[model samples]
Target chain A: MADVPTKTARAEWGTRFGFLMAMIGAMVGAGNIWRFPYVMGNNGGGAFVLAFLVLLFLLAVPGLMAEVALGRYTNKGVIGAFRDVVGRGGMVGLGVVVLLVNIALMSYYSPVIAWTLYYAVHSLLFTFTQPGFEAEPFMLGLFDNAALMIGLHTVVMGSIAAILALGIRRGVERIVVYAVPALVIALAVMTIRGLTLDGASEGIAFAFTIDWAFLTYSDTWIAALGQALFSTGLGWGIALTVGSYLREYDDVPLGGGVFTAIGESSIGILAALAIFPIVFAVGIEPDAGAGLAFVSLVEVFPEIPLGGLVAILFFVGFFLATFTSGLLITEVSVTTLAEETRFTRTQTVLGVCGGIWLLGLPSAYSVDILDYLDFVFGNWGLPLATLMIIGIIGWVMGPERLRLLAVNQNAGIHVGRWWNPVIKYVIPTVMLFIMAYFAWENFGTAEMIGGMLVLVLFPIIGYALMSVIEGRGEQPDTADLTGGDD
Target chain B: MALTAEVIGMLAFTLLAFWGIATWSLVRTLRQEDRKVEILKHQDRMDTYSPESLAELREWIENNPNDPLADEARQQHNECVDALKHTDMHYYDWSSEEIDRLDRV
Candidate 1:
């Protein structure tokens, strides 16, 4: 209501394939390429995959269906979508909570993407295969060099800003359609290369051997749960933002929910195939974890056949993975801000990208700062955002209404009553449990305190801001839209 | 360590289940979109809801006449019914009898 501009016609994906690719491109980031492969290797491999797959279908699929359906139904960005559902009040601030979390996440995330970009460029230079290339010094050289990290972070954000400035179809879709498939091909080639290496079969055995006993471990399920949700980027307002641009008659459940979730995870499976064999082949620690493994795994690339080329493929593909996610994560803010305020898309893109780059400077300056922020936000902020999104759908907007109206309207598959409770009950419960678990695990720590701060403050800020804003005159009458079957 | 048959079998199943299902979903949804485009090109409008979904819409509208979104729901339900009745070919499975039986909710 405060000096809002007349709205422009919304953009739609130029093609269905573009939409699907965007979802996959956004979801399959460093998590899929780096973390997923090793997480699978360490977590009883086949048993973990089974549990992860089950959780993906059970939670991620339905949660995404609801989120995307809300977006398409309202045809608006996060806050605007919230305004439509919750009406004109401080309550609309709940959407603000989502926006804040997304921005915070993207801030630290830009620096990480910068790491991938640096590695990708190095890969192209055949740096990893250089006889004198020392993995620790190379990685440390990049991490410790504040100027280089900042420059890379600036480049990543600038690239993202430039891409997002082109709008959904021309900018986002155009890039993703190419970037996603390229990542797959790179991984596929690496997989084949890894397989032909001496002792590569040991890698497969390590990754594929079923430890059925893992199914009985609570830790295994927890690990699987995190992998499933994190890899899919569920409830991150990402699916919602992407879903907002869905063309009329686009099916939400099949494309947005099923394909997006599974397709992204497929890349993880491919990554497991791509990386594990090589790690085992060269005798690196399989459980070195994502960060250590990433640095340690680099030395192995040169030790293998076609090592230089494989290095290029892995890093460049890794760059694209993180780059695409940076694009969409930034888009969540651009899309929402463009609609909520008077800013044009280009203006919004610059403002958002500039803000993120500025905030990311600290993280880029120090690896420890980046890790600290990552731990705090990744554990808490993401789930809180998820809870807000799915909570609104389940409680306020009503999953039954959403399924009946938007989800099933052009759904490729029928979503029955079974989907309703999952959206309403199961997801919120899981989110609460995640937060509680993290809080307990990190008790008395700075990370836990930072998380606790985000949990408490973000909603209050959102609510207070909305209350003041909505108190202004000449707002849209959203009364009828507020309550549903729930 | 040599790859045992158990490891080999598990690898195959994981690939088929994850990559196979993903590939299948991708093909199916893209195909569905193509079919929707084809049908839309032939007619001014295509049916928005599948038969099963349309019926659910009808049932929901009937049950929640006073619901805030009921009017929109009814309108959507009827739009599908109209498209199914008017279009020569349909995207979702619909029998001749079913089309004949369909009316505005």
Candidate 2:
């Protein structure tokens, strides 16, 4: 007499626009504006971009479609969805990824948000004039004290948790409705202005110039694939968990891809606009692993016109992006706690937020610690998680069942029965190839080794805990946890 | 003091490198052990019933009503039969992709 868990809240989007905007909020974040262009420049600019786009089609979009299908059909978070598709093992694997990735991101991401708030307030207070005079003073104004930035980060994290506590369609969705469009317009304006500068052509050229030789390298391809998965927030289970809330009628896969595409492409383009002009103008070498976003950009900020104002605005945008993502991650943790502990939703939310805040203290205290954590969880944890998710959905659950769940909610475009077979056998094989390729190029390095540990550690720990909790009873038969009706 | 600091840093780096390799080996070993346990569980379950019991089991299954665990039981039954060499498990190989072939048959 095992009972099916009753659906608590039907995660309905207020409108199609709201859903799209929220997806955009989730997809577009710190990585896009900060990391994309610099990485592209260092990695051979247009050539890398082209390769990344190819990987998106061959890997990311299909992978995303699969995740969205799992969410919409099951109407459950990562843990629940995996249990339905594969088994208890799958659930533990996904839970590990989601928890670790969220923890790693929150560690360093909050500090950047604080910096944004600091600059935004400073801009309004007349610390930076529009005429670009007193540039040195503006640059000096920021980072003169680390204490102020840390305080701002704490405040921002609290606000983020509060927004999530308000639930998806009401608070988080509403903010994105306005914020995403504003972000896009701001990025476009900045790009145009950057191109018009005397040294702007050099920047644009630097971004657009293709190095054909680098295209053949396996490392380049791996990096591109990783970015595609990371940028869209896949495998980490945030997107899938959000997708679980949707009504059955929505075109979940299409919606996910559209958001991912826009988010990923905009990041690549916007980072170019912010960085290329300055880097080329200043004669700094563009190297992919040189930590372009924070270190490189801040060094050049003092030279730009109304630099403080721009800095503030840029940080605001950065914070908005990361804040939206942080909010969603917190929601996942809270919801999981509520379901597992039989705690009320409010109690779970409060407890989870407090816990994440406490865990994130080490990261907030030092850049080196934050960087190491990010390297461990963000880089390696996500890809490993994606690989396990693909295996569960594409192999264990049987492709036909997965495909049926995918097509049940909305059936406009017909992919036919071949879809499941491809997902089952073909997709996982491709992911394996990609993962192996990554390991060949990057494994054995200290950073990657730390990353592999973080990725594998929690799943083992989580499964051990579950064995303790539900070990002897006729365990929750993972096979019986099927996705919802079409 | 500076010389001492450099020596300490090198030693820490070496220790970290050693730890990484050890962890990787441990993960690989644990995964192998888990797979072994899963196989053993399946074997023990299969060993619980004989051919006569399986035939009677099949008859009982045919008569019994469908429930959430019905599909699993059937799959496990097939696995058992395959293990006992009573029959091949290819009967369940009919993927949805083979639906057209199934229809033709």
State each model's CA lDDT, in order: 0.88, 0.58
Candidate 2, residues A1-486: lDDT per residue as tens digits? 346534364446665566666766777776777667666766665667768777676666666667767777777776666656645543454555556566666657676566556655655564544445454444434445446646666787788777766767787788888877667666566555555556665666666566778799876776676677677776667667667766534555455543355444555566566667765565655544224544454445555665555555565666677667677666666655565676766677677777766766666566567677766666566666676666667766554455533532232233345456556666667656655565666779877678667656867765666555545343456655344211
Candidate 1: segments with Cα more than 4 A from true spot: A1-7, A287-293, A472-486
DockQ, candidate 2, comes to 0.02
Compared with the true structure, the alpha-carbon lDDT of candidate 2 equals: 0.58
A1-486 per-residue lDDT for model 1 (tens digits): 755634677899999999999999989888887788777877888999899999999999898889899999999999999988888888888999999998999988998898888888888998788888788877878888999899999998999999999989999999999999999999999999999888889889888889999999989999899988888899999999999999888999999998898889999899888888898889987754335435767879888878989988988998899999989998999999999888889999999999999998999999899899889888999999999999889888889899998999888999998998898899999999999999999999999999999999999999999989989444646656554475
Q: DockQ (C-alpha) of model 1?
A: 0.81
Worst 10 residues of 1 chain A by lDDT: A287-296
Could you give the CAPRI-style class of model 2? incorrect
Q: Which residue ranges in model 2 land beyond 4 Å of their true spot?
A: A1-7, A87-97, A123-149, A278-309, A416-422, A425-446, A473-486, B1-105
Clashing pairs in 1: none
